[model samples]
Target: MRELACDVAIIGAGTAGIAAHGAATKAGARAVLIERGPGGTTCARVGCMPSKLLIEAARAAHDAREAQPFGVVAGEVRIDGRAVMQRVRALRDDFVASVFSGLDAIPEELRVTGTARFADPTTLIVDDHTRIAAGSVVVATGSSPSLPPPLRPVADRVLTTDTLFEIETLPESLAVLGAGAVGLEIAQAMTRLGVQVTLLDPAGSIGGIRDPKIAACAASLLGDEIDLKLGATVESAEAVGDGVRLTWRLESGGQETGTFSRVLAAAGRPPNLSGLDLAAAGIACDEDGLPDFNPRTLQCGTAPIFLAGDANHERPVLHEAQRQGWIAGGNAARFPQVEAPPPWPAYSLVFTDPQIAAIGQAFDAEEAHDWIIGETSFADQGRARAMDRAAGLIRVYAAPDGRLTGAAMIGPGVEHLSHMMVIAVQEGWHAATFLDRPFYHPTLEEGLQSAVKAVAERTGGTR
Candidate 1:
């Protein structure tokens, strides 16, 4: 067997693994990156980039259809599903190639093209042929879609984020399972693309928004474009002809059934640690098989071993994965002298039409009792009205001292607006600070000014 040595060995070449590899090398540590498949990250190959391409196409089609309401008649719009999908795949391949170009620039010997298993705390066996003796290991194996129990039997009939984009043609009808970010985004995009889409979620909210007011607004707006079955649980799923039939229990004590051309399951994602042989490395895992790790440091219970990205299951988004990778790689390079940096404030955004975003404390947190709330409706906002998207709301929260604590919004531009709140919460900015900044009129941002000022006034600040 071939033998190699390195200061740090990164498993999986996804977003986190790639970031860790770069950080370790930049920190003067000899790093080796291992992977079993093509080296493109998930976002580039499947998750974010390709999905956004499809959503953009769907949005364009939807916008053209809705243009008639503005007294500007657009001729009959027809969607060419095959052409749309081909374009997505073409652009997706280019993204994957770009990622490969970076990987190729790395020394060839440092890239291992095989699955790795833990032989010991500081040793990795790659495909039983080569052994790597590393001072530290960073596991960033990412995650896989989680299929629910009822859908397992008909798994072949269900599509996931990992497989949905590979379809040659869009389904005429789709029943989307789960109302989280993936489910809601795809449901809206598919609906706009002329698919009969029915979205089912056991939770009461859409896009995982915990605020009842915002959730209700999201449901009403999205439901207007598609069939949204909130507070509905899938009871059974079975193969029906070439498709699948699903029976679900509604919140109102009624059972409903639906058969669709396809079922896209966006249930959730679980850590991908199936065959890593982690026990050999003496890593302790929880009931759900997740390794215990420090959220701030990204280090596992075992010394010299760290978990980053979706493998830790702390924060599964791409940005969090990148941050965790940098921390884990730097700490792994330093080993026993690991540094713990202060954690960043939490922020998340869902790119559904009338995007949903949350920063810092969630809308339904118990601590909100001590925080003053301010809100604005987008129904009358000038920009929203002009764009024919005047159908959402924004809510901001501030502490007793008027410092911005949290904010959640469901509106046309909340994806970008949420970043403003992220900076406010992270920098300890007061509500009045937002007022001091100039907000251009007739923009969605002006609505945020109103919300911020309302919170400032409630906290006894000068209007």
Candidate 2:
């Protein structure tokens, strides 16, 4: 076999792997990036950008239909599914093109186009074409959507993020399984776009929300717009003529059935590590197949193997994935002297109406008895009332010493409001620091200020 050598070998060229290559090269290491398919990160192709495009279109339709409360008559709003999807695919192609421009710049000599399996701790064989010996390796193989076993029989009618966008026309009815971010966002968007949608989740929560109150508020608001089957397990799925028939059991042991033109299995995304012979490289894995690694350093045990992005099975979002990739690549360039990257506060946003935003740590009910709490409902907020869209909740948490701990919110514009809390947690800003700032009245900022003022009061700040 042909032979190649490098200081670092980065497997998979998704968002994380791309970042890894830059870090390794910047750290002055010879790095080879291997990818098995046409190069495009998941974000540009399916996850973030394209999905947001569809959501934006859905918002336009929903807004026009609901404008009567604002003393305006929009008459009739019609959804053109073909036109909507055409625009999504067209703009999605542009985003993929932009991403490819960067990938294309990588010199061919440093790029390997084949599947790679570990031959040893520091060696890889690429589809039997080339043997790569490297000082260290960074695995950023990313992940793929998982189809639940019960739904396997009707798999032909089931779609994943990987295949959802390829449909030429939107289905008249869709059954969305798993109410996590992906399921909720798609369910809401499709419902607004005039599709009959039913959202089912075994978790019994709307959007993986930690705060039960906010979760309930979100559920109530969204449940009005679509069928909600929380705490239900799919028992059987069958492909009927031109559609799917599904039977599921509720948490109370009651059975229900449904038929839909399409089924979206947004259940979960397991890492794409099936073919890589990790044990051959002396790396150990957990029962779930994630490597035993130091999260801060991104190093696999004490070995020179590093895990980054969704493959690590830690935080699967793009922002954290990109950050971990750089840290892993830099450490792989200087293996034995690996260093931990500086910590950043954790946060996540779900792009559902009455958006769900979680900042810093997820709230733990068992440990929250000692937390200083502050909250406000948008139903009474000025801007929300003025917009006729005020029907959600926001809550913040703090330590006794006044440090802003975290927040869980469900509100119309909480996606934008949550960033301030993200910065507050990241900078270790106290409640008093927030109270000291001037908040303009008749705005969402005023609502946030009210919560801040409550935190300040509880922490003994008179301001």
Candidate 3:
């Protein structure tokens, strides 16, 4: 067995791990980055990249099917799942390659690979064979799809997001368990590809984290094709012949059973910390495998050890993990006194057929700030009306003095719109500045002008 030494050791090479490695190395610490997998993130491999590609393809197919609405007559549109999957695989490979290539420039002293686990707070055991000693260690283990208790024993026909990507063929009918971002994104993507989909959620509404009005718009966009089974308690799940059976109790106290060619378990994600042996490292874990830590520093219960990303459990998103990892990595390398890290940025996005993005405090205007709310609907945007894609709204929360506090968008361009909101939230910019900036006319972005003006008007002035 070989022994290695490093100033800091970072386990896992996903978004957070990579960010930490970069920050640690830049901080003049000798860092060792390790991963059990040979390549880059699951996001690049199967999760975000491939899934989003498939969703974009599904959107194109949906547009073709609705050609008549655009005054363009076209023949029947059909998607070859095999071909689509092939393209997705190619894109996944390219993304992974790009990530790996970027890592090559990091100093040779700062990276290593193979399965790594804590032998002690400052010692990492690699591949169950080699041992590496370090001044500090940062854990960035990511998460895996959560399997529902009742469906745990079911086999084959039942799948999760991770398993679904490797499927040989798309099922004719799919029943998705959980109406969170994962379930809705996949369900809608599949529906556009001609698969009958049913979405089930325990909450009364879909997109639990989103504004209810935005979720209603999503429900409307899905039309009669996607079934909504809200406030349903799953009773049992079992495999029957080539399909699976699910019996659930509805919110009205009625029990119903349904069968589908495939059942997708998209019920959030559980942290990937089972093998890390937190006890040996003197780290404390909550019941859900999350580490006890300071939300600001991400330092675990013990010294010389920090946890970030999905393992820390504060929030789960690439951006959040990446930022937290940088803080943890820098703090671990610096060891004792250091400048205070920035407060965690709160933002989330759900990319369904109609995207929803939100950042900062919501529903806490009085507590967060003395405020005025500015709002605009997609219906008022020229580009939205011209594309016939208007199905949502944008709202900005501002202080009585016009300082922006929060921003949310639910409709086309929402993903891109979040960047502008991020700037406003980060800089504490005046909401009225958006109106004076002058966006190009005949575009969705011009809606920001309307939103800003509405907020200014409410705050006792018109921009």
Ordered list by lDDT, greatest first: 2, 1, 3
For residues 1-27, could you state the per-residue lDDT of candidate 3 as single tens digits?
778898889998888888888888889
Candidates arranged by TM-score, highest first = 2, 1, 3
Clashing pairs in 1: none
lDDT of 2 by residue, 361-387 (tens): 678998898888898888899999998
- Clashing pairs in model 2, backbone N/Cα/C closer than 3 A: none
Question: What ranges in model 3 sit over 4 Å off?
Answer: 105-112, 223-225, 364-371
lDDT of 1 by residue, 31-51 (tens): 999998856888888799999
RMSD of 3: 2.2
What ranges in model 2 sit over 4 Å off?
none
lDDT pick, better of 1 and 2: 2
Every model's TM-score: 0.98, 0.98, 0.93
Model 3 residue 178 CA deviation (Å) reads: 1.7
Clash-forming residue pairs, model 3: none
